[model samples]
Target: MSDHRWSPRSPVAALARFVGVPFDAQTYRNLAYLLLAFPLGIAYFTVVTTGLSTGLGLLVTFAGVPIVLATLVVTLGISSFERRLADHLLDVEVDGDDGGIELAFGSVEEAIGTTKRVLTAPAAWTGLLLVGLKFVYGVVAFTALVTAFAVSATLLAAPALYDAPGVTYTFGPYVVDTLGEAVAGGGLGVLLVLVSLHVTNGVARFGGFLTDALLGGAARSAEAADA
Candidate 1:
């Protein structure tokens, strides 16, 4: 006879895994990162778009050179911050060396060299690209989170709010007015909440991968070689 075991494929194991998702600390960290992404992404998008456009628009004049260089420097700084943020919240090891160009005022030659390096570095361009992409990612993440929570909350509270004046609960064509239906809705909400947590964590992992790829010097070099 085959020996019985608590395999992950078993129904009980699958249910336990689903139920435990929300209790994980990493899940909350992912949620916090996603929540912060929306506002931070908007800020990043505004700064990058304004700086790049203004700098490029004035490129015909001598003044445009410094403005564009300054924008690149600022972009590198933002990328550095993103690396640290991902390292902390997403638990990803983003490389410390982001091919940063150090500015030195010791001589005119040094300043010129730094500017050339910053303009040429793969990390700088990739970082700028990452910042631009972040805005889109943030919008999607925020929308998904809000929609998930709103639906889950409504379902979870259906039991108590179904009979309230001017309140009605409808799932598809079925009305959730009876106590049994309300309880069922609450159960569904629980499952939805758990599923949402898993989805959030998955998205966060993708964010971590993106951060590491763009912000890490080694990955940037590899990508450049591949290209």
Candidate 2:
């Protein structure tokens, strides 16, 4: 297994190291999980949003606020699903930190009470907010991912076919009247693809940071309790 552990005496350096990249096996696994998990999150958001929006719209009794509430409920389910997915995919040992979940309060009554406490807690709301943000982001990311791939591929390919001396036939909404234009457009497209890669990578890293913040429940709780 690869060791991703880094030595940083200070909090700031430690955070910088964590955010930059994983050098150890664990870090690599976590990063891979994060990358893969996002697409899963996108799919999860799409299915949930589509299904809930359609289903709730069908119900006449469900008004605007009710629909919002229903959506929130679905979002919660998605959050739980993603958490489990992350755990399984990353092989993250949440038990050590007791951050993922805690089964401290035993018995049905105690469990219910503890749940109520968690629900009412500010950290829980922050987690929900994080989920909401991720849902919106996932939807956008999925759209951009498809669009970028399509646009980049088409543009990069256009130079080959359209710029070819023998090939005159052009395609799509783009008007490549001349071979020069086609070749130029392809160059522009290649630049666009580089830009898209940067954007996607930025979004992925930002999403990972947000996930770390919102999903670090034990850390949040401990801090909150300390304060």
Candidate 3:
């Protein structure tokens, strides 16, 4: 078959191709962004969790829901940061040609106003929802990604590890019982790892769709509303 003919013809194939490609050049850049996403996730998780926790406490201690409101307002800032990061690392353009991010709103007063606007604006709320959704889904992605890597690595290293003297760490229960079992288990693990890559790519695509729904839903609805 021609090189083109051998290329991916389906989503699964595409994901396999993606996994097979060496992390070099533009691919390396994309993978690096994914790697860097963890720290960003940690920062966001801390801020939101802290704000919500403290705010709830204050609301309970005092009265009214001002702390809750404040927490939600702080969330607007977090949402904006998420969008910018997506655009920067994933090259996913989120804004309109003219709507422009409100960089002018740099002061605390302006940020408060922006938060108010974000609260009132359906589009902003939608974007926040998307960010929240992605944040939660990311936990699953990271877990699966790491599990796949670890399982695959351990399985592939079976020959060396299992055959080595005084080595008794089991991989899968069945696979570690004997050398033959190790080979079989390692093969299965490799397959599982390959399958995980497909799942990861699917998750990424779903995340993109979510971004569109939350961020562009307003723009689309606005056009429809106009009509």
User: lDDT by residue for model 3 over 47-159, one digit each (tens)?
Assistant: 66676677767775664254555555555565556556556655566542213334335787886775565455555456446546656766766776778778888887776
Comparing 1 and 2 by lDDT, which wins? 1
Decoy 3 TM-score against native: 0.64
User: Candidate 1's residue-wise lDDT over 1-227, tens digit each?
Assistant: 64345576887778788789977899999998999899989998898889889989999987777888888888888887888889789999887565346787588998899888787666678878888889999999999999999999988998988888898778768788899999999999988999999999999999889888777864557566879
**Candidate 2: regions farther than 4 A off:** 1-123, 163-174
Write down the lDDT of every candidate, Cα atoms only. 0.85, 0.57, 0.59
lDDT measured at residue 108 in model 2 versus the true structure, 0 to 100:
74
Ordered by lDDT, highest first, the candidates read 1, 3, 2
* Tens digits of per-residue lDDT for model 2, 111-221: 565555445444444545665576676667667777886887877777667756666535466567676887777887877766665566566556655655565664566
Q: Arrange candidates by TM-score, highest first: which order? A: 1, 3, 2
Best TM-score among the predictions, by candidate number: 1
Q: Estimate each model's TM-score.
A: 0.88, 0.52, 0.64
